[model samples]
Target: MSDIQDRHDSGGSGAGCGCLAVALLLAVVAVLLGRPFLTDDGDGGAQAAPEESVVATPTSERPRSKKPSGRRPGVVNIFTEQGLRGVRAAGTGIVVDPSGLVLTNNHVIQGATEIEGTDTDDRRTYPAQVLGYQKSGDIALIRLSGASGLKTAKFAEKWEVRLGDVVTAVGNAGGKGGTPSVVTGKVTALDRQITATDQSDGSSERLTGLIETNAPIKPGDSGGPLLNTSGQVIGMNTAASAGFDLEKKGASRGFAIPSAKALEIVRQIQRGEASDTVHIGRTALLGVQVRQPTTPSGGRAGGAYIADLIPGTPAEQAGLRARTTIVALDDEPVDSPGSLTDMLLRHHPGDTVRITWTNAAGERRTTPVTLGDGPPQ
Candidate 1:
């Protein structure tokens, strides 16, 4: 069950459409595990294309209910821009507080320079700002600007969920902006675990204690609600089985973070508690994409290779360039890209640190580089 494949859907059209296609593939999956449900618009600019359509097929064990009369009161459709790179992504979020506090999967808002949330009830779009996030747990909290008295989702008690319980997975499936998609099924398992690998950066993290269902969760459902029979939120939809085509298949298995666990993380974020796993605010950037070096024998060669440096970033301002190898950060040795990322995560924007690197000509150089604010990692 450990084998997982992440699939990227690029069916939509636009200027940066290809990026959205690639963004969908960024979901981490293990063997047979589906990618996290975040949809992309392809263009990173103001003009965005609508996400392709997604159809959900309910189980035959019970008759499907008629479509609800109106949109879910607390749920919102989420859209994000990743700087000027022209990559737009869409997902779902749950309103947790009346003052516009929203909860969602960290991946939904990861790397976003701008975020917008359209309430299902009001049909009004509001700008949003990330309050905090726990990247390891894949949970994030955001606040909508000028929002008040918003309806909040009801949470089911932790003891209320049981296997074989009927549940509905609701989300902005396929990144469609209007009414959220809903599919019903029974919970089949609990306490599930999986490793989600980000295809874009080869980074992966382990997710544990997930609720498993056959509710046909689809693209753009990430961070949406998995509601119990009484319309109480029991879990947050996170991932699904790869290639579970709803049009061709009756139902597909999906995974969700239990509401209890998600709520715990949210409480920590609300308390402004920053830990090894929780990031309190905006991400800091050295502004370089790096990779681990390999020797001729295919073994890792110590040091992170600077594949490219983003122009106008701290790395570029420090005179670091592509093809150089970063040896250390703040005097600590950097063995690989992951290690460098870990080191960076410990510091915040406006923090200055010593950087050590070697050029292609085997020339060693060291300097002080002040980090810059960047999109979420």
Candidate 2:
């Protein structure tokens, strides 16, 4: 189990959060029939919330249904295998529509070439495709192809959460991919900011304005639902603290993204809002590993050095190779590895661009290549 044990402040310690990633969180335990499955022990030592308490009317309350159900069958298990990065991840997803729209964490399925989901009520698994995703915010939307009659999860509007409110977390605890593990705990704090590092890949994310809960968010619990007493989803379980307890299981505290904020990002993705930081359809990949050089002061220097590129990818098709340094994209100077990613995100698959780089022989070169739709980043 994961423990994100920290009291937060709104002032925000904003640092080390940026674009570029190495390995996504590997939530998988086995590769069954070429599919990745995450396995874990049940909420090893997490705590739950109190039995019964009056629902406090906080400032964030929404117009709730008169009779809110306490049992959710809309929770779906997300299983992914990232082929390129050799990473396997698992998490939970909430069905939002009868037509099979599902919401999950971007990190849960990052770099995944094959995605699948199984609902709580159905034992049959369904293949899924990426609808959209925002890496900076760590949220994503996927669609289960050819699915119907799926139960949808209800979101608590009006921001009715409080510091002491009881909340339940439901998720596929051990990458078991069937039946979720339910844990309870109080809303220990709100609007907390945390920088969580993926132990599998060393990639880090600085998440802000999160709901801090004493409830345990285990491995394979990413993208699970943090539900209120009414069984309404109030937040999406995203990151758990890995601070001091990096080597200890169930030592870090758990954090979640507010349902309202997550829903807003999903709406934008559904509406095809592609920007420098957001991708509306499938993700685009150049198929190259980049590294940043340091300046004389040991600070990060400009230019992204191409350490390697995937064979047959656009990077290779454009005559780009390893040991090359990217200087600019579409005429924009590439200052860092993250900057190159930022510029590439502004475009979509099939779009053509002129890539400028310095060859290993110390000569500047330029080539035009069309981007390719790869996996979710």
Candidate 3:
């Protein structure tokens, strides 16, 4: 598992400042559709560069481990290659059905041009097709092509999870393949909210009602299962805390979406529900591309500067144009493009919002615009 950066209700600006494409637009769509990842521009930091994929080859054909009764045989390793950048991301998944329907974090598979997975039984990789995703829930479901008769992870029937209860996290730590990493810890808290960022693009997401634990949720651990002492999955490991300052004590914290919540969202996604918070397509549109401001020293310029507005879109209809600087959404301060994207996460399609911006005339203006939905990216 790689280091994950996080903050409590207060969010960070995220590190490794640079211009990635507007991939966050999809996140905004997720928000508008009803579930928001509360992302923001925290204090500026150096953005981490994209990591190259490392596929390890076996030297010897080691015998597979004997299956332990009650252990989850359906836990899978999810691997994805996103965009032309080929920014690879890996995480854990749980097989939900014998037909190879798998569930994991949306952030784990978002923007993936190609997705694949390795089942625990055979450890053989298979091509995966995304069924659909719910951004607000931060969960996604995929179907392994030609996969069947796979074992599935079992979920706890009730909210048997309690503070101080022992738990185990299983996932691909450090994005490394092979057997999954199992880390043990106790539940520290529950129903907590935190903001998580994509190291690949500096995009942030606000997650709520998460199960907090001291378990080492690392990179590639996202979408893995948080198992109880009985080996039944109680939660889905999602975000890990990193970049803690002196004020904070100990190592980074890890958070997971409650299995009940995650499972509910997955079922909704599987049903292809088209409700306010659940949508079947790509993302909602504001029809505007934003760029970050640059400091005189050639560093990052905070806040999103409108670069282009898709003509005939809601933004144009609301009188927004290129060269406008978005400073706030619904009165929330906007310090980076991610901030605006984060704010958009709180809204849904067909919803009207008060967007504040600075025009080329140096005047601040506010407008209420209705959001529109678009096809998947």
TM-score of each prediction: 0.80, 0.78, 0.62
Model 3 vs. true fold: TM: 0.62
Candidates 1 and 3 compared: the better one by lDDT is 1
> Per-residue lDDT tens digits of candidate 3, residues 290-375?
65656659887666777667666788888986777888777888887666655564455687888888876769888888887532
Off by over 4 Å in 2: 1-71, 196-205, 241-252, 295-299
Model 1 per-residue lDDT tens digits across residues 10-121? 2332221211123321110001011232221121222211111001122333443334322356898888776534456678899999999999988777767788898887
Judge candidate 1 at residue 204 and give its lDDT: 62
lDDT for every model? 0.67, 0.65, 0.62
Superposed model 3: Cα runs more than 4 Å off:
1-71, 197-205, 241-248, 281-289, 292-377
* Candidate 3 or 2, higher TM-score: 2
Q: Model 2, 1-377: lDDT tens per residue?
A: 11112111111111222111233221111000111112122332223222111122456435544332344778887777667655455667889887888998876666678888887866557899999888777889999998998888988754466676677888776565556778877777666655544433233456666776777666657788888877888888866422222123554356778887788888888888777656788666677766665555988667877767777788888798777788888888987665666677777788888889997576998889788877766
